[model samples]
Target: MNAGLNDLQAMHLRRLLEGGLPLDARPYRRLAEQVGASEAQVLEQIQRWQDEGLFRRVGLVLKHRALGFRANAMLVLDIPDAQVDEVGRRLGQAAGVNLCYQRPRRLPQWPYNLFCMVHGREREQVCQLIAALLAANGLDEVPHQLLFSTRAFKQCGGRYAPPPAKEVANG
Candidate 1:
């Protein structure tokens, strides 16, 4: 198993990743001070974390939907188990498909294993892209759903703060 983070490092990562990044020209300096580390040390540690798979991204979360994007849909695909990998890659490459991921299939009722997001200027445009994906992949008959957003409540990054471990008692 991969080694877990130590206390200080975990705390620093939690603050830096979950808590908002310092909004300054010398943000690293401010962040280091807050985390009780030197500026150079913070930068180095962030670079190291990037090298490791601890983080795929460390940046600002912009509000794309609020920025005049009229169409946004969460598309779930019920692809065959064997073809999931291939279809996921193709869906990821599809135009306007900003995000694509594989999820566990819930049998009978919930059959979708692939989920992706599509954003566009208009509903028609988004539908057209989805149609293109269906035709291009010869998956017109594949079970799927396009969940268009009626009201976007919250679109933000995941919370990176480490959850407090449960207390354990020994007999």
Candidate 2:
């Protein structure tokens, strides 16, 4: 409903999402049932939304801290423009480096562009792995920061509601 979706369509999607997907093999089918559509209809709409760049991702979010991977470190690298994509790919592919991406650099204050999240049972282990990754990738000369989260924050799925149809037409 935030962008490409109309009010009714987004409402249906939100209705299904708010209840969370069923764990069965036919989860989409179940979603369709709850949202008043067929399985294929739901799939096609979701695919169309994705193709239109409505959202970057749609998937499950795990609670790593509850799973014993307590140490969560966000590693930001000041990688050169030429190396950012390559380094981000490598980091994303590496074990324990779950999240990796390249963001715009903020000049005169922050210069980091490549970012990754590494998790481990212990903080020291996470640090050691980062060192290993830097050495292995020959990124020792690159400036970086490893910011370990001191506490867990409230985590939840995004919430949204579609605007009235009249507003959509008038605006």
Candidate 3:
């Protein structure tokens, strides 16, 4: 819990945050209005929560399909454990690579441990970008596979607090 914030105040603020910060010039001020706090107070509380490790980051969740980025691919690489981190860093910084992360490889079936997401307006463009990235990163010899997205899925930011329960009408 943040200092000077009661449980109710914290819960209310959290619920508002779960919905995402308002799209206003002074978003914190808007939030302050909703939570009945000063703009500075709201900012301070958010900083305190971050310092306490309550959340890793507040970032944008892009809707690639809506943006006309029709071709999307998840490039999974079979990078050796010792080199995964260094290679992932290089690939992650390459142009056209939107996202990159490391995951554990499942033996026999799923051998790839590193993943990268690349998006573009066309399949050929995405593939060419991936090829250039591989060559630039010296990963041409690395075993990998590109899984192109076939269907769109709903995307949204994280939600921490469960929704408030609705009241039932009594007969």
Winner by lDDT: 3
Residues 111-170 of candidate 3: C-alpha lDDT, one tens digit per residue: 999999999999999999999888888889999999999998677777778677689999
Q: Report the Cα lDDT for residue 144, model 3.
A: 96
Candidates ranked, most accurate by TM-score first: 3, 1, 2
Which ranking of candidates, highest lDDT first? 3, 1, 2
Which model is ahead, 1 or 2, in terms of TM-score?
Answer: 1
Most accurate candidate by TM-score: 3
Error of 2 at 6 (Å): 9.6
Give the per-residue lDDT of model 2 (tens digit) for 1-171.
Answer: 323445576577765664467898999888777666777777777788689997577777778889998889999999989878878888899887888999999997999999999989999999999999989989888999999988987655565655334644555
User: Could you estimate the TM-score for every candidate?
Assistant: 0.82, 0.73, 0.85
- For model 1 the local lDDT of residue 22 reads 66
* Candidate 1 Cα errors over 4 Å, as ranges: 1-6, 163-171
How many backbone clashes are present in model 2?
A: 0
Candidate 1 vs. true structure, TM-score: 0.82
